[model samples]
Target: MPDTFQRLYELIDTPRFAQGGVPRITTRKSAEDFAPRDEGLDVLLINTPVREWSYPNVLPIGQGYVAAGAIMDGHRLTRLDLNADRRVPISTLDPGYDAWLFARLDEALAGEPDVIGIGGIITQYAQIKKICAYCKDKLPDVPIVLGGGVASAMPDFMLKHLPVDYVSQHEGELTFSEILHRIEMGASMQGVAGVTYYETDSHGERTAIRRNPPRRTMTAEQLGHMPWPLRHLWDIENTYRVNPVGHLNQGRKWNQGAPESGGKFSAEMIASRGCPYTCEYCFSDYLGTAYRSRPPADVVREMEYLHYEYGVEYIEVLDDLMLTSYKWALEFYAELHKSGLPKRGVEWGGTCRTNILANDIVRAAREGRGNMLELGHDAGLRRVAYGVETGSPTILKVIDKSGQTPATIKTAVQETVRVLGYASCSFMFGSPGETAETIRETVDLCIEMDYRPEVFFFTTAYPGTVFWQLALDKGLIRKSVDGTVGPADDGIIERYLMGLGEQGDAVRTNFSDLPDDVLLQLTNQAAQDLNSHNSHRHPYQDGAPNSIVRDATHATI
Candidate 1:
């Protein structure tokens, strides 16, 4: 869930994929060249697919990056991203499909790896268990270990319900290493601090709920000790295609003049882990509550590496809150400027608060080479949504997002426009206390901001957010979108099956207390008003990155 690989790479003496400390392996089709034979290899495979319904998004692609990096550190990984290989015939949610998945597993194991480790973000537990069962059945001797964001969130539930041999809780880098070392030494798993295991009672029935005591949370320094995620393990260039709604795939056409225009040399880099903002709708709070940042020097070095090796032109810091500290931002930008890298102007973007747009930060972001920003202005009725579930400040307070408000948000938006000439604003619909009128206010706010020639929009609530919880509690979510509620786990598929476009109800909100037509009309009108500027197209060379051509470049106050 967090960037574990980035930290490890930071600790490395040299961060090259082909360097000596890392494992040597080929990703994608290259691995297939080896004759199929079980080498009796012991591997630790982590699956990141969050849910069964999420299968369409999983494929070995992303996991391969992590696994490949570990393999460079002398670990073997059988990465699985079910989203990538959609052609597989079996259903991921069906426990009966283990036989089918195992066939591929066996081919990979090929007697090469003696053990297989699996980890994921929780929702995939059912599917992961089926795979675990298959491993036990085929290679009964191999150990199956599980750990991930989900393991940390629901360790007890995972231990009890799944066939997973061990569940590593909290940050997995250290624990995973400990587990692997113990395995290599053939040590007992009983004393591992982050592990949970089961032992049969004298009655021969599953009885005891055994667990290792809690351990300390990992620090950024500690995290920096691991290997950089092995990007070589994945088909990095092709990963954009794995997701149906992946932004890269949206409106993408290959071989077109617009498509060929690659954006600046900026690379998406992780400067820190954990978000300080506790918006209930985020999983970050569920996994980590504190904020941590990598040392600035380490970050600058990575940038230097990017410039020398990859010809990267700019940087996109992928932190949840890159602007959490003004001092950190200033220092990082200053250090980066001195890295002796190419002076190619760079553009960066991230989620930040309007409060951070102080003159100094704006100057650095605008003239200092950082441009483009994403501000989360969840609702215009921030207050009511907090208490009465309206966009009132009171409502925002109730939802624990009091930091967002129209005044402060407006200042932030204006600051971006003042300094960078443009920025993006995100408003979440279906929030508590929300109604058509409140939504219209938000729409009106977007229209007002539209004059700056920025972006505006809404996104459906994905499962696992606090917003979804509220939706469920409000009975706004139901089974079989005929607008009826039912009692059942609803299997994750049904929970997310609002069927949006597929059911001809894409524009309909399940929050039935409000008139459906009214809600749709307001939402549509807001979108229409916001998009009014899209027709007055800015003259941009087709493939240019959206950031560089905008006024945000020299708009700083």
Candidate 2:
């Protein structure tokens, strides 16, 4: 969110500003009054820190260098992705962490910035209260704005609680600009699009209003025109050491030297904005449904720049599909082949819909080795899961996704194997009406498939998805996460497995009770079983933490 805001501010300087998520990893840290740049006071972004679950370094939480690169690029209009813990383990701190964040915020407040922006994610809702308390403590005089996925998805909840100066729901760029403009010009925050805030006349009681901000979708061409991200504004370099994932090992160095040997110099390139698939358990739909693409030439041009200017050897096409259109994909590969700019070579990969697989697309994907293809096989037991929610049709209708049926998935897999030789198949186990039997059915179907594929037991519940909202509304899950799924060390795998597998059955039979140790044992056993059967490599073992993660007591887990 800060990255986005910073980029936007650079483009228009419209009294708008962006910041980053607050660090929640330790209690020793504290927030203070922010320092001022030439433009204005710095906005401190805060969020929950990771202290749990150590596995799968893929798809890392991008921060620091990655964010810096994005800032250097025009892609980021408003900067965010400050704390790069992708699968952040859930952990809680005594009031100290909050106090620190508040202290830092107080310091920023002392500078009397035009407006303070508070960015929150669904997982960080509980932690946000502390941020609010600190903001009020130090800068009660300044206005605070809350925005981002968590706030937008549940505006009513944020408005009711939390000490936010204003909640900017939905896409916040313009709404934030309007709010900032109002604050700077001494105008009323009324009519600021997509914002939820307090009303002065109403005695500081929280108020909710629907402000219609213009939808300012940037084209790939237009993106080139935006000011590069302001990397200098963030403590990016420090966060890289903290990111659990290994995104850094993949991308190349900026010295224009040789590619990092063991791990390729890979970077995620968002060729297009939005996903065409609306899988119930996926996040693509929430990001935005509007499908837009960057010109292949422009993208290739950037690739060359990265290759020559910065010795990037591999580029991961982070787009929903690198081969959405066969012609486009082929042309992109062919251009790179002809450019000879990166004569050394480059490799890359991205998510693809199995149903859209084409021979040409597969052939193009073969351009560079170590390239991976991610296919969203949400459910192996399509029929059962599709039956429970009955939203499959709606999803298909809305997102126009292919491969809802077993036959299509098989074909897609076959095509992937034929073209890419290897692929990552994502699988979701539990859903609204899912049971052990149904889940087994899905697993069984995967075991039956001829292709050896990578698989993950993707949980059905999470924020920013139709399934999560449905689960919450149906009371399928507890309203608040008790570090069970939120914290890094909360035993996410154990919690989910104990609820759905053999141990879960055992616990149910034994008075519906299960110990954490039992659950952990069962979860590990299940993971081992699944790993052994599917021939899928264990993500936990690959580049896993070599040492124990340190705790406050000097003990490592």
Candidate 3:
């Protein structure tokens, strides 16, 4: 066996593994033996800190879904949102930063949770590791469960590395609830669907990993019945005051062209799940290949709740693709018009495909008011962002951007800006076939659109994406064993994940034919060129720290 797999074997060979039972891997340091509580399980769900500087600190909607499911199953849920805690210093350089995080964890553990759950995206691997290690050390007997993109993408890697008992794969709402139910009943997790767990032998030693069958994506009816995300668990007012919905109003200028709406607060909502297209670099399939949406009236009702409860003036629909079908968009917008939020000065924005935006009917709807694609000067549709990954037609095909070409991208962005007065476009560099000429084409297209774009300097090959497999095929990602074509076990994979968090916009791997230095220089120059066109440049675009600062002195812990 390779050294990495050997290390993994040793790691699992612990006292916890020896304490085998229905829910194995629970060995308490204290004298008391582990036992399932008769009453409801005290579940603690943590929303790990994302790179707050790059992204806004919105409500933990994903965790909220999981929490809602657990609550419905008679489990007590306590949420710890590390991202929304302004008391914690933002600077890792601060001396008390690590101590502060530990202290916060200690406070959260005061409830003595029966099972601890944590989650984040692939870029938050390092932070998730810190949280898992801390929780395991503090409560040795308590089971730790991980979910979200990190666990769904690389279940085996996370199971081998982190001190997690189980990984809730893919859509976690149903899976996590079932896991809790099984544990409450003191039943084995062997047949739990959409979960990855370790199966131990009679001697209580872990023999192998067992991944249950994937849970099917929720149907439209199921989605509509699903409970609303438990947003009340979070500090909503503070999050709005600090983060302020950056999707449409990044520079707080999205409303500059429209009439002065007195609304100040903001919130986020999602009306749909999954995307129809399987872009090479995206992990959309993790949510399943099918596109599912909630009822239009139900989504509009949630908007009304946010607007009234949180005094929200703007809402950023964070759906992967809100406008999946033309019919869905029309129905959703009709409900929005009926809610009268637009007349009440509540504006919202979401992502849409280039093809959908380029349609004449869609454009006309956007140009007028009281319709789905409303883009009137005082319209509720304040902004629309396009995932125009590249302007190079060759690279477009390379990434499998369905039905989108250079012309369609140009027309959609140009028309959006023509009607909305501004539109957000995102671009990425260093794909499998990226070249110097292709990089220039992307930059030139951004300039032609006359809109500053969010440019990601490196094309990260997130696990479970086609880009990741391509990287492995090209030897950009290497495994521990020689001549083995599988996921890397040797710390290479972990290091790659850590690099994603640490390097930020800096290049981690050169997927393109261009050399590393050449790619970096070209990407940096492209960002500079794009920055030159617009007066206001984003901090990430120029590789600078954002102006938002956290209070370090409030480290009361």
Candidate 4:
């Protein structure tokens, strides 16, 4: 065995030992695990395996929400979290990994569900494609539905290429329930809002595609009233055991700070959905630009459950932009403090914007002794990551990071470091007009703030973002001379999506004006400079000297 796999096995015993050292083949739990109602449609929700090496697996909360909505509307649901069932180390690197995944899928389909729904992000495009094809072959008559960001972003392309019968667009809880209701009633998908389906001929040949009107974004009240995620369906214990801390809190001292709690285990949750900002590189607009958050009380209730039931000592809030509304942030912190989770040793982290953090500091100064950071610490906010994507003003405008300038970025980082003990800032290279000088500015900004730079990512053009369209317009995403990129050119798009799963620090596609080699060299040099500058820093948790501890960084736009 390779040293990496051997070490992982020795450390965690994650891989099962079998004859000839092959990992055991594990399948989803049998249908007997869930009792389906006779009157409702039998819906199977498949949580396809993501790139596990990219980050540790968490309960698929997005699919959990979908399952919650289905059950609420009188539908029988069976969930298959393929990401959780792997019994092998470095499974994706193994040649038989795809076959093993298919075997698990086949076993899950043994009941022959009435309808199948697959949810994943764009990076899982290849895996999802294989899954959809396998399902079509095995259960030819069963209708397949696709949801989540991947389907919502490029509904037409997905409908034309994949074997999906319908693409459930944004905020899938309501739209998915409506899809199930229609399916149960044997109704046409014509007027179902927030969906993309095909119009078929008499012989069931797809003739054209019909995209229904977009659904209105859900309100905060509606989000609060939605069912709590069906976390019971997943192996929460195994998840906690195998990967205790999420990418955001990897090397933080808090992971080991709470010795009184015995040991630390982590889980991820989202307090809000949809980002209000329109950063050109992001595809969050697929769910609409309205920023809605669940009630603070409701959010705290869930946290309490995780704490008392699952012993989750750490939480990673996966909000797109957690600090969009300062009023909402304050309310959440107040509720969290009132719940006393912090006293019980629960610490959470989330992504934040520099403009919001800077403005919050200003408000704190005006209100009292500028104890906002201290108050948050008391409420269990351990880490706050800011997306200072670029230091150059020109690149900032190009990426449409509204209200963020170099001055604001500096102020936010310096203030966060002074008040919170440490600050985390993530930077990206290879914007549309990126140059060596812009890269230098970003590096200089990092040095000036005395913050150790995490990984620097190349700006990737995901399918539904403005960057994707720019790549197409600039002939980066190629098409035929006739100016049509259809199913025939599926390979072109598929290759690009596959490339997205590669290491982020490496150049994927050079959107910058600089040559590819030059861009790579600059990015590497910037990483080294930042690391060398902060080499002496040490991790600080409670009442320790503030410094940026080395932590694993993941790409976030």
Q: Per-prediction TM-score, please? A: 0.65, 0.62, 0.83, 0.84
| Per-residue lDDT of 8 in model 1 | 28
Scored by lDDT, model 1 comes in at: 0.47
lDDT (tens digit, per residue) of candidate 4 on 437-457 = 988888888878777764466
Q: What is the C-alpha lDDT of each candidate?
A: 0.47, 0.41, 0.70, 0.71
lDDT of candidate 2 over 347-371, digit per residue (tens): 4555555555533335546854212
Best first by lDDT, ranked: 4, 3, 1, 2
Instruction: Compare the candidates by TM-score and give the number of the best one.
Output: 4
lDDT of 1 at 512: 33
Which pairs of residues collide in model 4? none
**TM-score of predicted structure 3:** 0.83
lDDT of 4 at 299: 85
For candidate 3, write residues 1-557 as lDDT tens digits: 42221111122234442332112111111112223334679999988876533333468788877776665555677888787773332444456768878888999998899899998788888888988999999998899989988888988888999999999886677788778867766777888778898998899788898988887676776566566776777887665434566443555432121112443777888888889888988887656558898888878888888888777878888888886676777677778778898899988888888877666445565766333344322437777777887899889999899889887788878777776776677777788789999988988887787767754446767788988877777666552123333556547678777756432245555678887667766766776677632223322334534432233333333
Off by over 4 Å in 1: 1-41, 44-74, 78-106, 119-141, 159-163, 185-191, 202-205, 211-214, 224-226, 237-267, 345-347, 358-395, 417-421, 451-512, 515-525, 532-557
Instruction: Compare candidates 1 and 3 on TM-score and give the better one.
Output: 3
Stretches of candidate 3 off by over 4 Å are 1-38, 54-56, 87-89, 252-263, 360-372, 375-379, 478-488, 502-504, 532-557
Candidate 2 regions exceeding 4 Å error are 1-42, 45-112, 169-172, 202-224, 231-266, 283-286, 304-310, 317-323, 338-342, 358-402, 414-421, 432-437, 450-455, 478-526, 532-557
On lDDT, the candidate that comes out on top is: 4
Quote the positional error of residue 414 for candidate 4 in Å. 2.3
